[model samples]
Target chain A: MSITPEERLNVAMTINGRRYRAGVEARKTLADFIREDAQLPGTKLGCEHGVCGSCTVLLDDLPARSCLTLAVQAEGRQIRTVESLADGQELNTLQRAFREQHGLQCGFCTAGFLMTATALLEENPAPTREDIVETVSGSLCRCTGYETIVAAIEQAAADGAEGNDDAKDGAQ
Target chain B: MKPPKFSYVAPTTLDDALKHLASDPDAKVLSGGQSLMPLLAMRLAAPSILVDLQHVPNLSDIEDRGDHIRIGARVTHREIERSALLADRLPILSAAASHIAHPQIRSRGTFGGSTAHADPSGEWPTILLALSATMQAVGPHGNRTIEADDFFVGPFTSTLRDDEILTHVSIPTTRTAWSFQEAAVKKGDYGLALIAATGTPRGGVLVDPRVTVGAAVGSVTRLVAVERILTDEPLTDELAEEAAVAAAESVKPISDIHGSSDYRRKLVASLVRRAVVELKNGA
Candidate 1:
């Protein structure tokens, strides 16, 4: 006889400053939970294997590979995906810089790169180019050769110094 | 595709975990799942039960007790990389660890999991072997300390019993001087070949050389001939190169797609030369 785990686990957590409760399976991946259950498709799933960082997300303010994490494992913890990157209509500095620098092409890897860069900048606002490269090393971008993406981050840093745009209040 | 369907259990305590493991004959303890998930997805391994250890909170901290460093089994590689304690106390481990798969893999993969998985090309076995670290295995029989030499038996294999869960790895802090060099084709893949040595240099002589060659054979092995040569003779440019040559000759490598046996042997010799040069240059 096969025994299944009790299916009703209260997954109460905050995301983008809004609280949510989800009935999660013990086996459901955090990526599936966020996309299918929470309806946030910004966190793309590619190479469900951990190698591709497309499913990168912030778990309690730290960058994590969400595909490998179990949804039940994240109960009562704060989760953030790419959808939380900007205000309702305004683009965050990184997003705006990405546009200005042509950091994206097809845009499949943008969300992962953005989330990772956001954490990197928050931790070290004055990071050098080497730091940016190392921080984004986990994420792969098949398009643009990563030059514009890196330039976009530098552009964002430069823009932040010039105070050309209002920075978002906190991480999404 | 999702991993093959299997039963999962997250135990609340270590004792409960042990009980569950002892009860199930085909149970696998899930650590970071960086290695295990790939195996499950490929259908290479299909254990009846996966005993998840995430709920057991104690296995996530790094403890420094001055004499040795006790790393909890579940501590992620990122934690060790960012820790000042590891950098200051055991920098060789950090160096080897920094080369592990990548930042995201390092962020999720646990130190104990790598060692327990016992991949010859992976960083943990070579690093711990260099440090002469100890493995603490917990099973229904209770905890027991196994020295690094005795822990790893062969490729993708360990001394761990079916019911045992690796709890911690204790690395002695005293006389912990070491150096590491790894060569790989990409930024984040298993090294093509690697050489790691730990010990002190005294009076122009390399003392207690714990030399081990990785990513060469199906499993890692200590190069005793090189260790003996370094111990008795002073390490010079000529002698170091000869030692590297000897180390390469010592391993019996097989021809695989990653590289040919002849190629790996040459690469191993070159890496050893670089590693010894690093040592001679005060690495």
Candidate 2:
């Protein structure tokens, strides 16, 4: 189990609108890549076993568990982390709703929920309340009873429908 | 937990994949990585050479053959869940896919890997068993197909050889009404027990009714006696209840932190009845 030329490889990806290149061990996960190598730490790791969807990120606009994804595998994919949510000082509708509606308490699982909800709303503009519940069920939150989170996502979906989503895609 | 260091080889062709598999004794096929990566992170199973099949061509397509749906090995659970054709021909695929550890896991978990992993508690094994799906595999030797009933060997194991790769799963499209049900404590947790049933009504009598139960034992088990009881008989709620009871008595469940052996048996029986009721309603 020693390293060979194949074991150490270089990979590059456009993460949060910026391209990054790194040569490292093939065993690194996308979660650690974005956190350590690329220096974006918004993607949290609650349970690295893919049980907890805390390391969720948008892989080509689909919510995917970064911890389960190898860094080398993401060489050519478009990745968006929670850091891509807000442009600068301004927050996305989802983040605004989460704050306004008290959707998070400990704030550990907020990024995952936000990222997952982002893709859910993007795919289906007007998802039913049941759809919201099903989408949020992917990310685990211990503090809130999930009612507030559901309401927050609902508010974001409603906001997105009002022609504000385009201007707010980049937040700032 | 970070995965241990290993050699990564991404092969774009099946021939190269087969060569790598045959050359390296420690090479492991990396499909969706929804299951393998977790094991790698936990340091439970370490393979020195990782043969990533993500770049393998034509392994993620879903082909709708005239009589059967041929699903590629790299087809993700999310793709299956979103397939409109699968919803009609085999609603069980989408129904079961939706419950597989949420959207993130489903987005990356492959249909073939889950079938190859052969976790007794998984949704695919039981559904495939009930559907009598064909497991297509390619190895250094040659290509072959394994019936779903004969594919799964034990928990987290299958009849696939070390160098063989599960290429596709061919599920013969059924005109029958099917239902899949599972009881889990949480939304993403593995179910305590699961039941998949398919029944076709022919002249007011059901024909070829099959029931497969999982998460109660080492591998998927078909309720043959229950299928025999339902075949050629006019289906009724009372008859479904009797079949459920027979299914309950059929499985030898083991206790786990999820549920007790008794609880799993009762759960499977109740799920069997509910699945049958749902199937009856669907028809």
Candidate 3:
């Protein structure tokens, strides 16, 4: 179906294992749709552009910049946000590691970092310190610098975060 | 920043997508949306329609065509980075793909989209130019192939017409020593200067060397003078120095907030020299 420039399109996406339906304008980004329409504010919008990784989410289990992805483009796709990293009330291994490692200060960039690290650990359950640094280098954090963030991801990998059935089932 | 208003369509067939593009002059083809998304967010581009290629079939394959590898337009950088076939046949492309942005950006950015974007600082364009890859494009008229050297016109510019969609890129499988070097303030940022060099290592001497530099000039350029100096010659410290000087002297770099023209020229020289030394050690 061709959506006109000024017309709103009906788009549906499953975010954090819940389906959300919204009639959004073609210009609305997936990030805004998640926060405003879907009522999922766990995803942050740091740089509306792709430079900052604040709007990163798992599009079909692959990390993508939600701010750059239009809501209409994500129709009928699976989206995993930071909210998917927990098991109901308990924080997952990655999130717990971030808290234990003091990986956040201002906490604005924590959501993006959590989502990015969650995807990384799932792909490479045992990533080296260098691999962790390389993967998280695109994300910027002015609060806790980067050492703590890298340590948190490394800790999560060491703790076998990928094998956590609770987090995995939560994502489903 | 939100994207400006635009109509959108996700055509499942290439023919349908091409027909939509042919019908509207102000329509933009959305590939991976890595580069175009930012432009739309900034309102730098407000196209009337966006022809999304996500559902388009047969545009995301990596095939071995006997003598060469044909990568589809929708192939993502992350896919290239993890492809076993590319690692076996063309490892240089894999190595260069790892240097683009970060894991998140690479996950969604497409190889064809990067080439179509034609940013001077883009790694795919420089690597394709070095390998002399062929770009396959399908337009309203018909299908055609373009040489990598002729594909790029300037920064963020290519010979691809608005009504055309890049379908695939074919790189000939050749055994050659190669090295890719770039200098950036941080990893994933645009490089101050980029260099990709390849040559046939015969005995202890190099032959048919191709040296391509990017991000320093208005467009990706091959340093023929430097290639001429290195061809059929044994690589040494003195030869590397000469090639470096020739590379730095050959191009007119553009000055920007990232770096000065003189600084980029120096970066080109250093990167060229390093690549030469690495190639000499049998890269």
What lDDT is reached at residue B108 by model 2? 84
CAPRI quality of model 1: acceptable
The residue pairs that clash in candidate 3, if any, are none
Please give the DockQ score of every candidate, comma-separated: 0.38, 0.56, 0.85
Cα-based TM-score, every candidate: 0.93, 0.95, 0.97
Which docking category, incorrect, acceptable, medium or high, applies to candidate 3? high
Q: Select the stronger candidate by DockQ from 1 and 3.
A: 3
* Per-residue lDDT over B1-283 for candidate 1, one digit per residue giving the tens place of the 0 to 100 score: 5666566777889988898788879888888888887676567787777788888768888889788899999998888888898899888877777788866677778998999999989888887887788999888878899998998889988898889999999988754546688888876777888788876667777667788877887877788887877784666799879878888878777578899999988888887787777777773
Candidate 3's C-alpha runs over 4 A off are A163-167, A170-172
In model 1, pairs of residues that clash are none
Question: Which candidate do you rate higher for DockQ, 1 or 2?
Answer: 2
For model 1, the superposed segments whose C-alpha errors exceed 4 Å read: A1-10, A161-172
Cα misplacement distance, residue A94 of candidate 1 (Å): 0.7
**DockQ ranking from best candidate downward:** 3, 2, 1
Of models 2 and 3, which has the larger TM-score? 3
- Could you give candidate 3's per-residue lDDT for residues A1-172 as a string of tens digits? 7889777889998887788998998888999999999999989999899988988888888888899888988999888888877778888888889999999998988888887887888788998998888888878899887999999888888888883445356546
Question: What is candidate 1's CA lDDT for residue B182?
Answer: 86
Question: Comparing candidate 1 with candidate 3, which one achieves the higher TM-score?
Answer: 3
